[model samples]
Target: MSKVLTVDPSLCTGCHRCEMWCSLTKYGEINPSRSNIYVLRREPAVDVPVICVQCGLCINACPTGALKRDGATDAVVVDADVCSGCGTCVKICPYGVLRLDEDTGVAAKCDLCGGSPACASHCPQGAIKYEDINKAAARRRELWAMACAVRIRG
Candidate 1:
């Protein structure tokens, strides 16, 4: 089964540990700019953890065929050597999670660390989780329904 990185925004504390783990694991440095995951804080103290959902939309958009889906992890990965640095994958990515690495000049995004994601594993708040896609989808729907019920009661 394919897994995805699921986010529970309510659990996020905006500590940016996920960013640190991702960068450190990938680049051997604690660089937030190089991290695949990003945390954006809203005005009302809401911190949103954003990452590639492994949607694979960019895989088809890549003109050079640099983007391919990992069958084992269901991750859309960019091949730096084959990538033309065309930025098509970045633009096509709806979540804006893809970027061109400053040093490599190639498209970069989450590869799920081959199977176990460092960001998900190191998240202190459990805000980010690596889970089966079906389970994640069901959980999202449940959360949305609960939110809607609360709003309706309000």
Candidate 2:
């Protein structure tokens, strides 16, 4: 699963449809408890949706060795049998989306929508886009180059 979900904080209206989509996929409910995407406020000014950093903080936080990589891909898998649901992984997640399911008491979050994120599909504002890290980086670089060229001409 690709980890990067590029977000435009400026365009975020904080409607939280992404969270709803995430929860529905994970828990079959509208509850944010199952969502792996976090919506943070930049105050009355903005709301930023934060998802997995893919930095491996939650992966590293797994003390029971429940969290493991797919080896064949970027997907992260959790072994519920080994998971004690101590909330360590949940607490360690910087995005705050990772949460201990109140019902199951197990940690859960966005698993990349099983590689086809509903958030990106359902985003009304076009604020979220799922793409490869390398391609996204290249796009950003191109934007920066455009900015530099415009500056020189102006």
Candidate 3:
């Protein structure tokens, strides 16, 4: 079962707590540079968490083939031995999700905390969720419709 970490930008407070947790868990330090997950703030009022969609942009962009996923764990693992740290994947990520570990020089992303992400659990609001990828959007229809009804009523 493939699970994804989904985010509702509207619920994000731009606190970057997710960024702290992610960096602390993966890099053993509270360094955003090493964090795979980051909170991106854009312009007037847009705060969105940038994380791996597992859409394979980084995978496809990797020239050294160091970026690979563990099938058994469903976690994307980076092999530093083969990685050149050229930063192509980091450059290509549209979401600004992938980032270079300043010390290690390799890119990293949310590996779902080896199947149970701590960030999602630590999130104060219900903005983040670890859910089935196949049925990821199944609930969106209902949610959007409900929002639409509210708009009509108000």
Say which candidate scores most in lDDT. Answer: 1
Give the Cα-based TM-score of candidate 1 against the true structure: 0.94
- Screening candidate 3 with a backbone cut-off below 3 angstroms (N, C-alpha, C), the clashing residue pairs are none
Q: How close is candidate 2 to the true structure, as a TM-score?
A: 0.79
**Model 1 residue pairs with clashes:** none
Residue-wise lDDT of candidate 3 within 1-154, one digit each (tens)?
Answer: 7777787777888878887888788778887666777788997777877667766678878999988887865776778798888999889877777777778777766678888887787778767778887666775565678779989999
* Candidate 2 displacement at residue 59 in angstroms: 2.2
Query: In model 3, where do residues sit more than 4 Å from their true spots?
Result: 42-46, 139-154
Q: Native-vs-model 1 lDDT?
A: 0.91
Q: Estimate TM-scores for all models.
A: 0.94, 0.79, 0.80
Query: Candidate 2 overall Cα lDDT vs. reference?
Result: 0.74
RMSD of each: 1.4, 4.3, 3.3
Q: Residue-wise lDDT of candidate 1 within 1-154, one digit each (tens)? A: 8788899988999999999999999999999999999999998998999988888899889999999988888788888889998899999989999999998899999999999999899888889999988999998998799889989999
**How much lDDT does each candidate structure score?**
0.91, 0.74, 0.77
141: Cα error in model 2, Å = 6.6
lDDT of 3 at 105: 77
